[model samples]
Target: MSSSQLPVRAAGNLRSDAGRNRAEIVSAARAVFTEAGTDVPTSRIARRAGVAVATLYRRFPTREALVEAAFADQHADCSRFFSVVEQHPEPWPALRTALRRFCAEQARDKGFTAHLLAACLQGRAPAGAAATSALEAERLTALVRRARDSGAMRPDVGLTELHLLVAGNAGVVAASPPDQAAAASRRFVELFLRSLEVPRRSGAGDGVR
Candidate 1:
């Protein structure tokens, strides 16, 4: 019938446009939600996207749905986090860079879905709760193992320890002064690494030292 529909059907450009528009909506929603909270107003998101509230509803039927999508999107961004392991092919530097980004993201995004951020004040924002944690931990353990086997890491640093450290520092990132927070990750990582390094003592007794 209409030329638009015909060409879209033929070239499939219509689907591409729809996908791009949906992504834009999600991106906008994520931006507002991260800065705001889980209870962010629907109209706020729509206004930010320069779209109608109906468009926002069409893309995300519910607040929980939008929150889940935003959480997933945040996790997806993790893969692209810079890893020196991928470049210099070592583990500690990669861990340093990755953990630094993790700290930054925790400070930046602590919506009602960011688990393990010590967001107890927010009371643990579990988007998909157990399911998401299970899926995410699987991926994290794999990365940890890879780094450990590469010999740039200590054998004791497992996923649980990693999670604890991230959780511990996330709050510091949030409450500390801006300039101090900016360097918190590097400083924390350095101290943690130093603690993890091989213990060398000029003279020490196992029970007394």
Candidate 2:
């Protein structure tokens, strides 16, 4: 091949390799983070990806960048679920489904649960995460408002209580053994949902507060 053609081919191959390396690094990061926490070393993720630490660093300069990339798909899943909830006609059922989904996700991925709790409760978000968090918050606020308006949810229940429910479920899942976490999370979600609903009453003013 001509020298100019050779250089072009080399450049194309290099770009292809770089893309592959990035994909591997992200896949490895997700697996490692799920098994261990996000605190695991970068070198370990590099080794798991079968890539050099330098390569991983080239693709993601910071640990948070790697983490954000690793969980990107999960975040997309969340956005999609929120969109589905927004379209549901019954606000209370939609809210309950969303809560159940969140608890199930926490049971499935401890690292993600820790990351989400830290982001939602502690107001910490990596580079591209802030916008996504804001969008989700807006969607949740609308859902809560609709539920309250429909009288299915207690008037006092709001985002703060919802955040508390999430934090509480995260703790429940974390404390439970692996084999029991999912069931425990489900039970916790049901209990929280019941508490958030308007109480049934047989007499006037009996269910107030």
Candidate 3:
């Protein structure tokens, strides 16, 4: 999902209309940002959204505000994504499926992708926490719950640690080639998950580092 910022004229209007227009702008901005990257001018965002530049400014007075709003929408989208995962038969495979989709998105989209890098600079590029940024930390929380229940992921693993892992992997996959990066990223997840597993019974020899 993408969001666009409103221009000046779009702002200072009726409250409900202003709110609706702002929401529309955000949706447009999300698409534009994803297609054009954050470098794309906010004017372009307004044009893409079919709103006047003044309207864009009226709604979002600053680039940072627009950026934050777009990121938040992406986060909301992520929360909705959990609905898809809930359909899965179990959690481990479900987590893998989610990660695979994430890898694909990171590899393809520019706006949302750049957001990942921005996270490193404390730019707060959206990473599945915008909407739920308040109380729900579903992605990492789900992964940790599944891991702990599996007796595979270290019981010590928690939401923060898992979120970091997800963020790190997204950054890595985003920089990778668009075609095969999803497969490669999924491999990374698989290996990580495998490493968390309890050791097999000593079939033959003691484990080696």
Candidate 4:
């Protein structure tokens, strides 16, 4: 090949190699975070991806950036789930499905769950994630109002309580043995949902919130 053509070919190869290395690093980071946690060292991820630590760093400048990329699918799924729930015609069913699906995901994906919880608590999520969270929160508020208006939920129930329910259940799922977490999460959500129902009273307490 001519000298000029050689440099162009070399650049093309470099781009291809960089793309492959970035994908490997992201895949490795996801697996490592799943088996261990985000706290695992970057060197471990590099070793798993069969790339140098410098390569990993070149692709993802910060640990959080790697985490954001690794969990990007989970984040997109959650965003889509919330959008679906927002469109459901029935508020109660939407609430129930949202809780069940969210908890199930939390149990199945501990790494994603960890990042989600941290993002919510620390206000440090990526821009896209933060927008999703805000959108979900707004939809949740509307859902809660609809549920209360329909008498499916108690008058005293509010949006903050729903947040607490998800956050608390996420912790339960995170703390349980991986094998049993899904079942446990389902049971917990069922109990919480039942508790939110407006009760039929027999006396003067009938209207109590």
Specify the highest-TM-score model's number: 2
Indicate the residue-level lDDT of 150 in model 2: 89
Q: Please identify model 3 stretches exceeding 4 Å from their true place.
A: 1-24, 35-41, 50-52, 61-77, 83-90, 110-131, 160-164, 202-209
Q: What would the TM-score be for candidate 1 when compared with the true structure?
A: 0.59
lDDT of 3 by residue, 1-209 (tens): 33455445534567777788898899988888887677788888888778899999998888768877888856667667777786666666676566556555765676765564444223343443344443334444655487578764567756554455556666667667867677776777666656545555664566653
CA lDDT, candidate 1, residue 181? 76
User: For model 4, how does the per-residue alpha-carbon lDDT over 28-86 read when each residue is reduced to its tens digit?
Assistant: 98999887768889999999999999989999998868987887887778778878887
Task: Report residue 49 deviation for candidate 3 (angstroms).
Answer: 3.8
Better-scoring candidate (TM-score), 2 or 4: 2
Residue 175, model 1: lDDT of 70
What's each prediction's TM-score?
0.59, 0.83, 0.57, 0.77
How much lDDT does candidate 3 score? 0.66
Best by lDDT: 2
Model 4, stretches more than 4 Å misplaced? 1-9, 118-128, 174-177, 200-209
lDDT of 2 by residue, 105-158 (tens): 878886776676565544556444666765666677788899999898999988
- Model 1 lDDT per residue over 84-154, tens place: 23564665566666666666666666663355342322223355333554554554555667677876677
Sliding window of 10 residues with minimal summed lDDT for model 4: 119-128
